[model samples]
Target: MAKNVNPTRMALSRLKKQLATAVRGHKLLKDKQDELVRRFIELVRKNAALRKEVEEKLTTAFSSFALASATLNESYIEELMTLPSNDMTVEVIEKNIMSVIVPVMNFDYEEDFMAQPFNYGYLNSNIELDDAFDNLATILPLMLELAEVEKTCQLLAEEIEKTRRRVNALEYMTIPELETTIVAIRNKLEENERSNITRLIKVKKMTQ
Candidate 1:
């Protein structure tokens, strides 16, 4: 929208003062846009790195489980058949980072899956392999967390776009409109002053 502010000779000082304020506002908004873009890109790179590590570890965990299953006695494994498979627990708590608090998930394992003779407990050698599996499972929630961070970056980018549009409109349209109006008013005032001076000189000569 074009600004319709009228500035007279007496009001030039006020218009200049307000223009200074508007210029400062434009600079501040520009700075904000630059900072948001910088941070958003940084988060994207971090997300890529984290995903790579999680995938590699997850692949290793899966292969370990396959090896364990093959090494154990298939027929003799009936004793631990009742043990849980998808038996994991997690808790998400909030923690702050640069004024934004994100969720952190904690993993818990269900122990005592099988209780029997001393030699009939879980596969002891494979317990570390299972622990590896659990650790990778823990990374699942963090992946979901990275998903959330990525979403936040997208939203912030959108807001920055809208703000930039408004700033451009003001700098290119509104300020120019005000300046044109002020210049027109000053020219009219000077023309009127010259007309009055000519009239006063002619009247004085006629009286003489």
Candidate 2:
């Protein structure tokens, strides 16, 4: 690439301009990559915490539900779970972080007919069933939060990789090639100037 550039003042000027732009672009991309890395790390940490919390809660909720199921008639438990008293809608919205669009989930619940377990009756329901329902409902938002964080982390990580690649291309390849072409042009111009001066001196001596 450097060898193909014409070694002249005009070429030197053009090469210098390209080099400056490349350097500036490299700096900006490098900064972006750094910021993305920072954000990705933070999101990863948050995701880990949320995942752990959600896992623990899910285990507890399921275990409690299982325990309650063991004592209750299978047909009755299935009937109770089949009809949900609450309506839920999940709305997804996009949020920008470091120019990356990540999703934020919001759950909108309709009017609650019954906010507690055994909404039909407490006669046959155990305390474990109540505890299970409470835990499950409480973990809903946490699970959504975990999903958001995880997706954000994934997107940030991808952007970081792309930015790093571009930065490397400018810093290592494009900028260096331009600078080398500039140097070659300047050297060629200087050599021509000396040759002209020497030729003029010889012509003067011959004229004298």
Candidate 3:
């Protein structure tokens, strides 16, 4: 259906220009959507792999802790848990991916603290407990990386949806409406020109 625009040369010119712009915009947006989807899929795959690794490591860590708990004295375990350990800090920064802003995280820990041995006595602490702590520490960076990737996928997904909507609007609605309106105006102008020619011929015949 044609848009409700005036059937005049000026309106037709304006509509043609609008149609051209809409077509260009649609192509650009479609390209953007494709790239965003590609990046999103890659991130999703990475997220899946990282999640699997993190879960498996966590399971190992938990199993070790459970074994240690079963073999060790509850009071002593409680005392060991109460002791303060190393301090870690996370710094959050933003990065742009296809105009979408996502978070990047950096972790900082004290080098001296990490270099030192466990505070607990060797006789009281079992190997299982040590393994559990080591596993948890090793996966800390992976856990942080997993978080960053998941958030990036989320942001890209949102942008893709928005771009898809715009592309659809231009492809299905705006461009079609302008084309229909321009065709209608051109037909009307031609009809008026034919009528004028006919009237002039009749006037000449009568005068002759």
Q: Among these predicted structures, which one has the highest lDDT?
A: 3
Q: Please report, in order, the local distance difference test score of every candidate based on alpha carbons.
A: 0.64, 0.83, 0.87
Model 2, range 1-208, lDDT digits (tens) per residue?
A: 3656777788888878888888888888888888889878888888999999999999999999899989988898788889777777799999988788999999777445226533667777888888888888888889888988888888888888889889888988888777777777888899999999999999999999
lDDT of 3 at 177: 80
What's the distance in Å from true for residue 144, model 1? 4.6
lDDT of 1 by residue, 45-108 (tens): 8878877877876777677756766776655444444554545576767655333345565655
Estimate the TM-score for candidate 1.
0.61
TM for candidate 3 is 0.92
Instruction: Give candidate 1 misplaced runs (Cα > 4 Å).
Output: 1-7, 58-121, 124-132
